[model samples]
Target chain A: MIVDEVDKQIILATQAGLPLVAQPYQAIAAQLDLTAEEVMQRMRIMQENGIIRRVGAVPNHYKLGYRYNGMTVWDVVDEQIDYLGQLIGQLDFVSHCYHRPRHLPEWPYNLFAMVHSKTKTGVTEKVNIISQELGEFNRQQEVLYSTRILKKTGLRIGR
Target chain B: MLSDFYMQLLNDYQQDFPLTPRPYLAIAESLGVSEDDVLLAMQELTDQTLINRIGTIIKPNKMGKSMLVAMAVPEAQLQRVAGIVSSFSEVNHNYERENRFNLWFVLMSSTGELLQDTLDEIEQQCGYSTMRLPLVADYFINLGFELDLERDQELDREPDNGCDRLSTN
Candidate 1:
């Protein structure tokens, strides 16, 4: 991410998360001495460039009543897991989906997805839906439930 | 019930919030409120910690390499062990799960070699074996959830100050 001076100003200003005032851009513009239009344009360019992922609030699912956090791992055919992961990820019930390297014997699951709901049963329902999605391709599966959140700190930039 | 604006902001704009110069103005227009009013409400919601921030959520492994690591520590040493792991600059998140494999954390780095080296260092320091699950593939990874009003009060937690300075790894 090669950010120029103006982009740096924009990032340093907004990376902590966007300010929440009425004239939010103007507020950032004042600090950078760039026009509000200019600041927005720079951020838009950054987004297009992948410097910014998406502009919005990242809801704390736990805080949103997703009481059960299940890490669903699946043993799918290697060649198919990549394609299967994409299909499963598009399911509304799936919050997070990934392809992770598996540790053989002890951990033979290569596909991973995170499912969350308000209760354990709610989580099971979602898992069942996923299992059905995987069907014959899923050789085996395990749902690892998070017991305690030992640490939940998100990286804060420019700290 | 969620305030009309709250529903609109949290539910309607999950996937795409405006990227316009006056983004809030655009939001305000849709919500039938003045731009300044929308700004005030958003700030208050943020201050209230209902939302993390009105900014970007970078997808992991998008820019740099990262891995999910697990360490099996005896119950007695979990805390001290976790502290050591969390202190490392590269450790993004440290978690405790239900299995015998209790301690898990994430590490993101500029290179894959750096990621391996960090995991090795933790294994040596903590005296416990580690499991590394690197991002071999990404299925569906993104975040957005419309608040279920029925569980609003039940879902509330101590809203931590989120804007405090933290480093971007």
Candidate 2:
């Protein structure tokens, strides 16, 4: 999105993650040859424009004692999928929910909800809650549990 | 025992992480602790893998194009397929799941149109069918985990499910 020199620098610096320090912006400012205030101001603008989503900790669910996690997909009516998605997203257990295109007869689920819990029972109960939530519109659904994590890492932005 | 300050760092800052230059100092002031302590705990949390990282989650479709891709690799070819998929820098995350379409990976590209060609090449290279599930709309997307310290002392508390749309705040 028209990333200027400063914006580009900021993304690269924090892409890995803002360092765990007291003055992270100051640290970035020192590297970019700008004052801490300017760096903070620019990032505020970026956040306002939706460029920087949120500045916070991204925890590894696998390390958090959340042993059981499943991605539940639903084939809901296309017309009402958005409305249904919002309702599903609000559920406490549904960490990440999205409306994605389905491939066809082979892949029919359009709504994806990432459900996480400490145990299988927790996941099952949450799935039941979601099913009840989408009772009428739920056509077909499936939960794909991860058998192995081949790779897990954050998105790398500019450089 | 999970320190009160640590729990506060997770619960309070998950959402409006301070936009100031000295956020840890700000947090320290509020939590009645030293700035170094706040920084140390946050660093410790990250070092121990409790938190993946402390960073900005860029909004989707803002910088580049990404698609959720799945491949049905016969058990025999799963490893080979994974190696091929992982070799591509565009793939940020890949996983093996319990399903006929077992190998799932997210492929990202700087240019949006390149997505198809890359997927096509991967399919041709691996001789497997790859399904593309591009994101359409995000409802609630929060990637942060609150650690939920209260649950230990208070069993009656309901699980707090606070999710923002994945990439967007």
Candidate 3:
């Protein structure tokens, strides 16, 4: 992708994650020899372009007391995915939601949902609510919980 | 152009740092700032909720085996199911998408078989079917935004790790 100069700097600075300092942005600007406004502006552009999803910290849920979390997949009629997906996305506990092609034999889900909670019981309760609203789900729905947290960081810049 | 300070912070966060006590202090020293300043900035970010949490990144494949699983949970039972699904430590990220397969999450385990077993348990527990999709190929794009910052022309590179299966979980 042909990224602009200002966007490039901002990408480099944030890709690694923000510095641990009082004026981290200021520090980034100083090193880059650019004004604060310039940096912030570039970031805004990248966000608008969808090049950057959001400029924020990637939280470690495990460390933050979110012991129970699961990725749920569903097999719904292709036509109904969008309708149900939006409703599912609105749940506060749900973090990421998207539509992916169903990988047959091995993967049967056409829609995906992610949820985070404090305990297994809580997660089950949330699942029940979703089931009730939709009336019913695919014949097979699976929840995959996290056993270990691997790499969790922003994208590594192209450089 | 952004102030040099923010750039410095970005630079610090870009690499894997030493797993040392007082890691923030070391970062502060490198930036020629007091340790307190580093701590405060971090606190401010967290307070504002701009930062979710700071921690180590685990390499899933190296640790064992894992799979990306999805399921369509009924709308009425979405919340209840999520609460139950999250209870399992194996589920790392959970999202509600606008699709038939409404629930999606990543299941990481020390072995692929173990991951499957965990999914089975979830199906039995939630009374739903799950479709497991191990990553076929991944285009590792480390995307980040500066909100309103300008782009730098100097740092441009190509994507790394193409279908190697070694890079993804």
CAPRI tier of model 2: medium
Q: Each prediction's interface RMSD?
A: 4.9, 5.0, 13.7
| Best candidate, TM-score | 2
In order of TM-score, best first, we have 2, 1, 3
lDDT of 2 by residue, B1-169 (tens): 3567766776677656788878888878988889898888988778666566777777776677888899888898899989998877778788888999998888777777787788888888888888888889988545454454543442222332321112322
Q: 1 or 2: which has the higher lDDT?
A: 2
> lDDT tens digits, residues B1-169, model 1?
3466775676666556787667789888887888888777777667666566776655555446777898888999999899889888888677777776778777777678877888888888988889888776665445454456452354255543221111122
Candidate 1 Cα outliers beyond 4 Å, as residue runs: A1-13, A29-38, A49-51, A156-159, B141-143, B151-169
Q: How far in Å is the alpha carbon of A111 misplaced in model 1?
A: 0.9
Ranking 1 against 3 by lDDT, winner? 1
DockQ of 3: 0.05
Q: After superposition, how far is residue B165 of candidate 2 from its true place, in Å?
A: 17
Model 3 lDDT at residue B121: 92
Candidate 1, A1-159: lDDT as tens digits: 676778866775775677666567788899888899898888888878777766776554555555566777889988788779988888765766888887877888888877767778987998999899888999998877765555656653211
Q: Residue B13 CA error for candidate 3 (Å)?
A: 19
The DockQ value obtained for model 2 is: 0.53
What is the C-alpha local distance difference test score of candidate 2?
0.77
